[model samples]
Target: MAVKLRPAGILLAAAGALAIAMPVLLLLPGGGGAVPRAAPVPAPIGAGTMPVLARVYERPLFGASEPVEAPADAPRLVGIVGRLNIDAVALVKASDGTTRTLAIGESVDGWSLASLAIDAAFFTRGAERVRVPLPIEPGGSEAGTEETGR
Candidate 1:
C-alpha cells in the first residue's frame, strides 16, 4: 500500500506543525524580550487616584430619573435632626427662610428628601438628585479642618 496526502491534509499538517513549533520558537534564544507586555499597566491620571465615573443610570421602567443638578437657590441643609433611619429628619431652610424638618423620602416644596448621611442630605427633584451639606457655624470649626468626603 502506498501513502498519499491530499491538499487539505497537507495544509492541515503544516498548520499543526507551526502550532506545535510556536512555543518552542518563543523559548528559543534571540526571541524578542518579554513579548513586549500589553502596553504597560496604564498609570493613574492623578496621584494614585482612579478617575471617578459621574454617569447616572436611568431606569425608564422603574420611573427612575437621571440625577439633576441642584439649582442655585436650592434649600440648604442646616443639620441632621436624626440618625439614618425612618425617623431621621433633615433640617432644611429654604430660600424663603422657612425651615422644615424632612424625613427620608419626604418632600418639601418640589424637593424630595432622598437620603441622609452624617453631614449631608440628598434631595431629588424630577430626575436630579442634589446633595446639601450642613452649613458650618461661625464658631463651629474651620472649613478645611474636617474631611468632607472629597
Candidate 2:
C-alpha cells in the first residue's frame, strides 16, 4: 500500500518547522541580545512634605444697598384738562412749579398717577396720596370735585 500526502500532513510539517526555528531565531543577534536591559523608573522628589495647595476666593454677584426714599416735595394735582369715561388727562403743578399734563401711570417727582375719577386725578408715592380736582363750572353735570376722604 502507498501512503499519500494530504493537506493535513503538509500543515503539520510546517508547524513543526516553525516551532523548532523560533528558539534558534530568538538566540540570534537582533532577537535576544548578549545583555538584557532594565525597565524605566521615575525620579524621586527631594526630602520634604508634598507641595502646598493653593486657595481660591469668590465675591457676591448682586450686592445689596440702602433703599431709595421719595422726594421731600412730591407731585400735586392742580386740575383736569378734559375727561372721558373713567380716565382723565390731568394738569399737574409739580413741586418745581412746572405744570405738566400727566396720564394714568405717569411718574412725576417720584410719584405715579395711580387712578382717575370723574372730577379729579390721584397721584401716589408708596402710602402718600395727592388729589387734584377740576374747577366748578356753571350748569355742569357735577357741582364740583368731591373731597374724597382717604
Candidate 3:
C-alpha cells in the first residue's frame, strides 16, 4: 500500500522541519547571538511616597435635588394609556403647541420621561425632576376619563 501526502500534511511537515532546524541554526557560530536583556531601572528617592490629593465632590447626575414644580411653559400631561409602568405612554402637549406621545425613557422638550403612572408622567433633566399630572376636567374627572354618571 502506498501512502499519499496531502497538501496539509506537506505544509505541517515543512513547519516541523523548520522548528527542529531553528534552534540548531541559532546555536551555530554568529547565527544571531543570544539577545541582550535591558538593565533594571532604579526607583527615585520619593518614588514610594504618594502625594496628598484634594478631595473632590461630584454632583449627582440623576435623582431629584429639591425638584420644584414644572414651569408654566413646560409640557403638560394630557393623557396616559396602559396600566403597567413598562408599557405606559403619556400624551404631552409641548410648549410649541404640538401633542406628542412619549414612552418611558423618551424625551420631549429636553426632558426625558423617566417613569409613568396611571395619572401622571415623571420627567427628568439632569438632577431635576418634574411630575406632570393629567389635567382634571370641570366634571371633576381626569381629562381622558369618561363620566359614567355613577
Each prediction's TM-score versus the true structure: 0.46, 0.36, 0.48
Give the winner by lDDT: 1 or 2. 1
Candidate 3: list runs displaced more than 4 Å. 1-68, 143-150
Off by over 4 Å in 1: 1-70, 139-150
Question: Which candidate leads in lDDT?
Answer: 3
Badly placed stretches (over 4 Å) of model 2 are 1-72, 134-150
TM-score of 2: 0.36
* Angstrom error at residue 82, model 3: 1.7
Clashes of 1: 3
Per-residue C-alpha lDDT of model 3 across residues 1-150, encoded as one tens digit per residue? 999889999999999999999999998987968789899988888867745444223434575566457777567998887776557788899889999998888888888988887667888888987788777778786544775675
Ranking by TM-score: 3, 1, 2
Q: How close to the true structure is residue 129 of candidate 3, measured as C-alpha lDDT?
A: 78
Order of quality (lDDT): 3, 1, 2
Scored by lDDT, model 2 comes in at 0.70
**By the lDDT metric, which is better: model 2 or model 3?**
3
User: Residue by residue across 6-106, what tens digits does model 2's lDDT show?
Assistant: 99999999999999999998988887666766888755676265444442123333533432343457565566655554556777778889999888889
Name the TM-score of candidate 1: 0.46
